[model samples]
Target: MERLFGRAWLVLGHESQVLAPGDFLTTRMGREPVIVVRHVDGSIQVLVNRCAHRGSRVCEGPRGHARQLVCPYHGWTYATDGTLCALPLAEGYDRSPIGVEELGLRRVPRVETYRGFIFASLAPDGPSLLEFLGPLRASFDDLVERAPAGEVEVAGGVFKHAYRGNWKLVLENHNDGVHPAFVHASSIWAARNGAPWDVWEKTGLWVARYGHSWMGDYHDDTRLVAALDHPVFREYRAALERRLGPERTARVLGELRWNSLVYPSCSFMSQFRQLRIIHPIAVDRTVVHAYSFRLKGAPQQMFRDTIAFANVVNGTASPVLTDDLEVYERVQDALTASRNEWVELGRGHGGDVPDRDGTLRGRTGTSEIHIRNQLAAWLEYLDMGGPEGRADAPAMAPQSAQRSEAPRQSRNAPRPA
Candidate 1:
């Protein structure tokens, strides 16, 4: 775990989450407790959430705004920049070899933000965020460009939940469309009952550079969107048309390419306007944190839809996602069986075509290309080192066992509104 995570660039939080001075959000960068805070001057800082004096957490909540972080154990204080600013007794420290400056909250070493997304690295040196993200950058582009003003703000609030499973299990599941028909049979019975067939026919998978992969639509299915007939959605569509023109607006909002997972920690599906974080709590447990976004300059109802879509798809009690969580726990339990050795990554094997960027996309959506791609990345990180050591691998594209099959049509008819 340390080798896989401790040396990589991980997301701390979004810039919008802590927009105001002193606004802070607590999160886990791997197993380490981290605080993403904004200072009065507007600079962002990521501080380790431990007190220099007694090793207690200076900031003890999930989120809060504070002038400074004061240790609950002692009076030692730190500025929003993580600079040690105060101590209860100066004379006591004068006798010690360390100065107050030496005792400031430890910074995460390398902190950077790209397009309002904040990330930190524990290792001192590695690829820049640009190199690390590579083609996955398009996901952010598709997300932000959906806004008429070309921007998005984290709105509504965050939804946090967890499942009893390995962290990789969630990442694999994010793009594993073959399971919805079985695992999620009850929840999506009306639409996705025969998931391998239904989802396979509708969703095509794309693998991008740096192990980032996503599922795009094989055919236009606007029923889910058109059914969202509300004053807010109408206004939002009109606003998008004014900025993006009619054809483009339809392509952007009407056809959603959902479940874009940026390897290691986060996934954002712009069509749904939702972002989810996969935090590894242990070898067998994972916490998922989700947030909804409001495209700046879009209709207010659009933000409401973002929340509604997330609730149905990934809410704490989501009718859809809860089914997956239960299966993940059960799968984690089932793996303990003596006969279990390896899980299948052979779905739709060999259906991938080169994406021309050292990555490949599946000819069929049901292909295990996405899962195998991520596991390849995981092995690379755990063995070869993170992004820094990935360049030496065989184009970093692990080809599935050679085979080919045409997609089957979905058996279930579209559900009525």
Candidate 2:
């Protein structure tokens, strides 16, 4: 955790969760608990939830509006900005070198927001959030620009689930492209006769620097934006056209990206308006929080469709999600065996073509290039020297299995949002 999430920029929550002064939501940076609050000064603060006095957690609830944070264990009161304001029996530590002024909650070193999504980093210094986001910022733009009012907010609450599997499994599965055919066979059968396997051929799989990757939409009528004949969808499009004009509206809706991974912590779908944050608790356990967004100024049915998509695809009761979860646990269980020492990620190897935009595109949509790119970034973050010097080198396939030339291309290529 210290090497991966501890030093990386992680998503805390959305700005809407703490919009008003004193509104706060509790989340975590890896395993360390944190409170994201809106201060009276109108600034957002990400503070450690541990009390300054005895290291007890000051905030217990998931979310609330509070004037100040008070530890139930010792009744130590702290201001919204994390300044220690009051404590019972002040004479207890009269001679101690530590003063009340120094007991405020420790603020995270850096906090930044892209659009309405907030991110915090525990590390004191590194690449700025924009530098880290690189080309993936367009994914966020694709989401927010869909709203006629030019904003999107978290809505319909959040769906949280825990699984007995490594956190990396979920991120890898999001863009695997090959798993849904077998894993979601039941859901496909129930929805219709079978899956549209041909959609894979039309979609594009893109991998960028920092392990971020996204796939183009299926472009079939089953997509969220494909209901052109529905009056609600027409209204929604007209609203967007009024705000963005015909040309910009065409460009915005023309974006076909589906699932986008902001490496290490976040995965989102622009079309369905769903955002999920991955929280790693232990090596074999993880929790995910799924949130649905409501586009401002869009038709009410649009938000309803967003909720329906969440319930059908992301909710705990979802057949589609449960199938993936079961597979995750099964994979975890089998991985403990001593039989296999390496996980092969060589599907579509040597077939990732270079794009003019500097990203590596899988030769086919069903390739495992996304996983290889993610593991390469994983090694970079852990500072484990490439496959040559690492002790656990056998755990991975090989360095040549990944697209090594793409980074050189990315370094000099112009980043397109």
Taking the candidates one at a time, how many backbone clashes does each contain? 0, 0
Error of 1 at 342 (Å): 1.9
Error of 2 at 314 (Å): 1.3
Across residues 111-228, which tens digit of lDDT does each residue of candidate 1 receive?
A: 9987888888887787788877776776777788788887888888889888889988877888877777777778666665343476575576877644678887733334645686
Could you tell me how far off, in angstroms, the CA of residue 399 lies in candidate 1 after the best superposition?
Answer: 18
Lowest summed lDDT across 10 adjacent residues in model 1 is found at: 407-416
Worst window of 10 by summed lDDT in candidate 2: 408-417
- At residue 117, what lDDT does model 2 achieve? 91
Structure candidate 1, residue pairs in collision: none
What TM-score, computed on C-alpha atoms, does each candidate reach? Answer: 0.87, 0.90
Whole-model lDDT per candidate? 0.75, 0.83
* Candidate 2: tens digits of C-alpha lDDT, residues 78-128: 888899878888777755423455688989989999998999988877678
